[model samples]
Target chain A: MRKFIWTLVIVAVVAVFGGRAWYLHKQAEQNKDAIKIGVVVPLSGFDENMTDRIVTTLKTATEELTKKKPYKIQYLFEDGKYTVKDSISAFNKLKASNPSAYIVLGDLPAFGLRPLINETKMPTIVLVSGDSGLPAQSPYLFRMSLSSKDMIQRLASFTYNTKHISDAAIMKIKNNYGDDGSQFFKKYFADLGGKVIAEETFNVMDMDVRAQVEKVLATNPNMILVWGFGPGYTTTFNQLSELGYKGEIITDFGVFDKAVWENIHNKGDGIYFTTIDSQANKMNPQFLQNYTAKFGDKPDVVASFAYAAVEALLKTIENPKGIEAGLYELQNFETAIGKINYDKEGEPHAQIVIKQMQPDGTAKIVKE
Target chain B: MTYVLHQLIMISIYLILVYATNLVTGLGGLMTMAQAAFYGMGAYVYALVALNMPVGFVASCGISLLVAGLVAWILSKVVLRFRGETFVLATLAFQMIVFTILDNWEGVTGGSYGLSEIPRPSLFGWEVSTVPEYVLLSVIVAALITGVFWVMLNSPFGLSVRAVRDNERAAESLRISPQKQLSRAFVISSVLASLAGCLFASYVTYIDPTSFSLTESIFILCILLVGGSGNIIGPFLGVLFMILFPEGLRFLGLPDESAANLREIVYGTILIVLMYYRPNGFKGIYSVK
Candidate 1:
């Protein structure tokens, strides 16, 4: 009788724990109307600053959305750490950890997540540098940021059409992002009847770009086209200013961070960069006010893109047009980042705007 | 289900890595830091050849092994000249140089943007595409590697290497060439590292320079050190503890923003406690006399 009682006690204890686990798991499941958004971002590592802004803006967007939607919307964020392995690990973990309606990838490269996303078949909005072949690989994948090619063409057009600076030169970091921008700008500018006099490339961590700067200025081009990010970009500017080359400098929108630009603004005074238009700020005044009040400053382009991705994802989830079809039908959706439209390739069709940095570290839109 | 499989695959890959690391750092008593470099070389070589040619999995692995072995041999010449901390510093230089080559050699390695669309490993034309299939392949490969490692640890060559690790002069007195033994050990370690890298590249279908930074080398070393060196099982357990313990933190209900930091703290505390209470590690075989 004692042995039987002990066995019964063990079984009962196991049943209680198992039953509670099952109940918790069931509670986590959606009850016919809840939406889960899985956000993969670099919450740690080199890209943390950018993701910090994105997470704040994304939360604001989600909160604003919950009020307007009938369903209870929730977000589950995962840290990708800005590496391919970590990104995929985070994606897999997110899927297993929760039930997500869709995924939003912030500031991570698109190619690394392409295979995994194809496998998952989850509707994903990637807010990062775009790749032409990414969407085709995974039909459920959509991009919220402008492609490097698109931005380069816009920069080239503005410089040639408005500024009328014909002779141009190129110096870029020898990486994919830089290579894309440099190649496109060279071809487009050359096709527009401008001569690319000098083209030089540097490694990602090359601090002293004096040699490349000298080669670029040797051609005495009417303008210089540069490409890079972070300290490398700033280092190039420092070398150019020190070399006393006063030609109009052109680069991509990545150099638009006010904090980074503040110190190097005067070095490249006539510097111009191209990015997706800031009409989102114009259209969503309330969002801007709230974001500014919370963060004590305005959100950057990356943050705006992240916010747009969340808003678009939530809208799709609430109305439920199916995964691929719903994202496809999400055309001309107005968000904090202006009117958003995606081409058949899932590439954003947002207009590009060129802005000139002032001495005070503020950027003004170039009308032309 | 797939998530668990993914973690298992990752564990298998690191098992090979930590095994190779144990050969050099645990058994050989060398503190080289070029494991990530060799791993990257293997990944880049495999990805490039497979993408540009009609090579299958075996051929790609062979070529990657050859390239990694050659690099390891050349580095060993310089590394064998140093002792103690100097050896580590020299290998650190090698790691940085290899990383620079991978990052700047844009035409071949694809530079910072990384190489993607690497074909899945196919054996006799059977594609390993699904998570379950990949997991099985990884398990088989890991088992084969472990079997080889076991043979090596019990062999005459393994004994000689361990002798050199224990005492260079005494090993020489016993007619063992420390230079030759250390060199062989390093070359073998590099070969294993390359194999792991090839598997990772094929499995992930992407290769980038960021994955092979100095930080990664330190991480591999931490696995061996914390798991207790000088034994095969120690490294295996170390890899599992290092990989899975942190992963289990995901279920702790911590806020997302603080979870990553807290996980790090928890792992750091574990390491500290282990170092204090059981320096030889749970399944460790060697201890300071």
Candidate 2:
């Protein structure tokens, strides 16, 4: 029995690795003529709805690009699962394909891949809203979407100048996203002489934020800044409503999701959040129409970013210079999201706007 | 080639982790869920020192090992008083506490934002920067750990620990101190785990609290359980299987939409089947209860 088991284990190991090697060779041969663009994103483990939207948008955009481009463009995706270790693993797997460029989603994967990107000098575009400093870490790294710093600065300025809010409380999720949002808002708001009277935090997995909401309400601030993503948004909004706190509530881009509004029901009404400027979306109505027609639903901000990333990559590839050079030279490049301009640091600047939730489960632009 | 080297590096690191874990859970009969905590501690210490102190990789690793071992020694004194399920729970609590500290101590740990720009490992005018170099360094460290563990586990101290694990009262009657042996085993296990952590930090160049969460500890424990722990070869086999099996599934050419989920399902199913067939693991002399 012992000898048989040892033989079985050895056979299994040999079969797995050997099969993988064969499969990789076949894949390489098949895609030999195509321009391979590797995509590393969370295909599992974190925010399935968002991943689904991003993947669908990439597929749609890629199909459109394939028809127009002179050469074949193939996208090979590896699931990063939105974690550092898995992101590194995913990038390593994709490295075997020798892609012309890479598209990495989220902040964690970008940070994890920064050193590798510097080493390999791969022209990679990261679609992220948090941590504006990421693109500075690597010359080959380019960013899409308005960074959290930009959006929060706009939001803080709007709050203090337009809304005349002097004091505020903050309720943020406990992860990096929440930390960035809270820290940025506090710094920007404090610079404008606004006082953050109270601050509280809850985990992303928390089903209840009554204690946190109540703690914030006890401070009796003029407004509150809620920063986080996922179910926590719904929970925070619902708890605030249950507690009968009627002060002005502002949030980050996370509340733009339909799921959050639906989950909070009417509780999210009158809440304000910062997101990409709607003027750009208005400028390109056909993208919204095509996405809705194709997917049978409207595209969220994340999907728009994904679509824009593909468009930007296609434009960069068309340039006479290489991807890295083309990325640095991009200015006023129009895409599905809006016109994009990459500074010398490879960080793209986009317009940010604030929107207010309505009782009908839709949001209206309040500030731009 | 880099991808292959990356996997080999990860396997080498996990080998150290599993071998260290075997000392406490496999040989000493103490199931610990705090390996990742010590692992995180080591990584954080190494990262902080390397980033701030301008120390070489060897000194950073030494400091990490020392800090992790000291914490493990203190924790062992408190947790070793309990037995079985209670001991496991105590270790779980420690893991949670460590995770919270790493997650909330934003000033030091960067909170959940994670520490980035960690310099690569260097020793005596040689900088290990490339993936191949990292792979070689990790393998050498793992080999040295294996040699030390091999000698230690074969010594009389190893026999005494096993004797205590099998029957603490009997070992005590025979003049062996259960507390002393178990504490030493636990501390040594943690110190080795920290070394693996140090290697991981330098190899990846980025780490966040999520990398060292409770899930990772469970994953490490699972590797030991699946491979059959009480001995060196058992955990070694477990490390290769647990690390490579999931990675191998990635190459099966599943559809992109369902591939990640499918890989997980298949991996879980295989684990269940393996455990069902071999309760004590393929080559393990002792089964974790």
Candidate 3:
């Protein structure tokens, strides 16, 4: 009796997994005619709101595109949870869906899937701001977001030339994004004859950055550059305000996250951030209005990039050339973020602009 | 087919890791929280050697094991002085120290940007580049490690370690050096973990500090706890349940918006219920005190 029960349990376990796999395989077969795009994004963990926006924007764009296009497009999303292991798992799970192309968010996911991308030779679009140079490593990999080098160049130029800031301190998250921002800002700022007086780092899970903030303030630099993502930025901003240092503050487009500004409240006002050009909004005037009306919230730069990825993929599908060749042939492709151009290295060159946060938790372009 | 291969490879790598954890925590009865650190050490060392040196995959893995073993030996010397929760805390501190080094050592480890473009494992002109090839390599490695562990555990050395685990005073009365045996188990456990790390780095061809965080250490410990420890079959059961079951949840076709969270919830709940019903795990002989 005991032996029979154990056998039954084992059979049941296999049946559950086998049943699900068969169901998904059948579904994939049924949708064989549709162009499947696998999207890996963080649906949990840090930056959930940001990924939620990406999903919403992708769905909205795909819905609109499918209605007008000749061929149907299908997007299958897998939750990467913004980590390397989960991203790889998500990618593998999405493979069962039989996607022709893939879209991975963040540097970690792109990096994790780099080897697999090479192995599979699937055309993948990576939406990442950090200048990790991953897109250049794989021919099939194309980057959709602005590079950190370009954004830091503009920020450094503005800090030195426009604002006349002679020295700055950096408080950055201790990851690829933070490392790139700090490294690039230092290099560009030094080239522009400005000095980085001090640098402090904190982990993403760190809730209190008072120690790091205190150290940065101790340097007494003319401007402070804060580079990070997620809710941690709010803590940094609030702590900076608590420290009561009267100096200029600057960050990246990550500051535009609603969770950050709303939590930081008025503390985020007067801070400048480098982001994709506001011309992106001007090019698609209806995007902001439509996104707001549908989602009941404003779309940030990340949403625009996500929407643009869908647009770029659609263009590739429409082209007579294949995914890889079509991607390279794309020139001045219209997207929510204005016109995007892909260089020979598969990295998209988009205009970057500096914007200042308003007291009402909105950003306005800094007029040069 | 490729996805199945990928999961198999991952399971193989994690099986080695769980075996490493099970050796010290299950048999030696010294709960460790630094498996991921040793794992990371193995990966980084393997990546560095592979990228910079002319060494092949075997040599890289050998060097990684040597380095991780040395660190584990040194760590064992310090952490072995403590017992129970204090020992666990010491191991946890070591984990944090290693993570900090990996995160901040920009010049060498590439810091948080991580070391990318890691070459696939090649042994004397035989490369494990393809997914199926990697699956085969990983499975062979996992099997060899399992065989070695079985031999080690069934030997007199294993009996002495278990004796010390059950009662250190009684084992010492029997002339079994508790400190020496435990240290050996710890070092051996860590070296095996580093081996898994090497396979993972070469397999993924990319690794960052985030891959070897404290969370991972806790997860490895959880695997041993849930699968049962202090025995050979326990680690295998733990690996299958801890790694594959959560992955199997992905196929449930849950709504995308809540799928990740839902999977986590269901997984967590099952673990809790399992522990509540079977405190020592499915096949565990010794539970952590």
Error of 2 at A277 (Å): 3.2
- lDDT minimum window of 10 residues, candidate 1 chain A: A100-109
State in Å the error of residue B21, model 3. Answer: 1.1
Q: B129-149 in candidate 1: lDDT tens per residue?
A: 988999999999999999999
C-alpha lDDT of all candidate models, in order: 0.79, 0.85, 0.87
DockQ for the candidates, in order: 0.40, 0.51, 0.56
TM-score of each: 0.87, 0.93, 0.94
The C-alpha RMSD in Å for every predicted model, in order, reads 5.7, 3.7, 3.4
Candidate 1 vs candidate 3: the lDDT winner is 3
Residues A1-368 of candidate 2: C-alpha lDDT, one tens digit per residue:
99999999999978976887788789778768988888898887747667777777777667765675677778898988888887888898999888999988888888888888888889998875577677788899888766777878888998899899989998988887777778888999999999899999988778988988888899898899888776776788889889988989998767778667668887888988887653334423555566688656677777777887877777778888988898888899876666788998888886677888888867788943
True contacts kept of 2: 0.74
Residue B183 lDDT (model 3) = 94
For model 3 chain B, give the 10-residue run with minimal summed lDDT: B249-258
Candidate 2 has which clashing residue pairs, if any?
Answer: none
Better of 1 and 2 by lDDT: 2
Cα RMSD over interface residues, candidate 1: 3.7
Q: Which regions in candidate 2 have their CA more than 4 angstroms from the true location?
A: A1-30, A278-290
Q: What is candidate 2's CAPRI-style docking category based on DockQ? A: medium
